[model samples]
Target: MELNLKRQIGIFCVLLILPALCSAAFTKSRATFYSTSDGLGTPTGRCGYGDYGRTVHGGSVAGVSNLWRDGVGCGLCYQVRCTNPSLCNSNGAYLVVTDYGAGDRTDFIMSPAAFSSLGVNSTANDELRKLGTVDIEYQRISCSYPGQNIVIKIKESSTNPGYLSIVLFNVGGTCDVIAIQLSQSGSNTWVSLQRVDGAVFQISNPPSGTLRFRFQVNCGSGLEWRLPKNDIPANWRAGATYDTGIQF
Candidate 1:
């Protein structure tokens, strides 16, 4: 009976540890860098983040091809490390996916800053850049931005009271925002917003009133719905940002 009890306890411990181990597992891939004079991401990248993409994560950003998932992969974070012991650091770079790109048989086309972060020092970094491409391993990681909540940005293309286009910003956590629905205040009917571009969602003929939003997110473990504490004003304007007052 004691032996059986010990076995059960051991199994329970393994179950607890397994998830952490799995989360840390890195998959092998190839990575290359894009040219930006300042080693930063492009404001005009495919994600539609604009100037925010240029400085997000302090410019440690990447463009992923296969992982794009029809724009769902935008804003996802990953920890990437190069395998070359002589030229690369083990800790690697932590980057946000802000664009879509594909390289010669590569999964990640990182920003110059992100690619250089894999090196141990300036000398190594220079050599790595000269190589132009390298073997890398990467794993998805949760994103966190200190002192920032989820922000909804009204795209400049939106037309008042008829069309609404918005983007999600500072979307932390390891979840993918799969869907968003907007409803008029105190109304049971919810209108689903469609993904029009990377990180951009839109709806036409939106209900005319104060609007509240709910997001459906999947964090690999499971799918969950998140509701924001704030509501969009009836007279929402283009080029404005609304703080959700919450994080994923």
Candidate 2:
């Protein structure tokens, strides 16, 4: 009886420890900063997102290189804090991966604005010149924290009924959309959507009916949105398309 009680205590202790382990998913790395014209054009990045101003979570933006998994890293958010305690903020800044760079051996490349926003310096250029680079820690965070989520829209191609154009918008949190799938009405099976570019997915010969979309985010989470059957245009004709606005 004593042995069983001890085993139960051990199991309870292990369960108590698990949440801490799950929360500490951070990595240590070096970081640098860049500005808009630092000889790098307004990069559309691998994730195919346009340049927004710095100041994510009220902090500046970060440009990561080696971490860029094509465009998969585009819309994900990260919490970055300087390793140098004196240079770091009590609350590290939040940043989104909007661009990529030719990463140095370091782990992150911050936009000039992002670096300055971290209280590293008054200006990104000044921080770049003063620090050149710095040590930092980063970890992935959920997209829902920002109260935004991925939005998918579908449009019929003007030229072909077999080709459907899908676009993503208001991509908050997950960083980038890696995989997309569609389900036709009356079918439990899901069909994969092909990437035509950063912003577009193509479904060839899509069925005529209501469809559902599933987006696999870069952070290993999945989001789903469905369009009701009646929402689909009747007799989907060639060159005809419909747009389903933002969905969860």
Q: Each model's TM-score, in the order given? A: 0.90, 0.63
Q: State the lDDT of candidate 2 residue by residue for 82-153, as single tens digits.
A: 766555654455566666666567767776545654554445335544887877777765333323334444
Model 1, range 39-78, lDDT digits (tens) per residue? 8999987778998888897788899998899999898777
Q: How many backbone clashes does candidate 2 have?
A: 8
User: Model 2 clash pairs?
Assistant: 34-112, 46-71, 47-71, 60-114, 75-175, 76-175, 143-173, 156-241
Off-target runs (Cα >4 Å) in candidate 2 are 1-25, 37-43, 51-59, 120-125, 145-149, 153-160, 165-167, 170-178, 196-200, 216-248
The residue ranges of model 1 lying beyond 4 angstroms of the native Cα positions read 1-18, 21-24
Instruction: Name the best candidate (by TM-score).
Output: 1
* Model 2 worst lDDT run, 10 consecutive residues: 1-10
Worst 10 residues of 1 by lDDT: 1-10
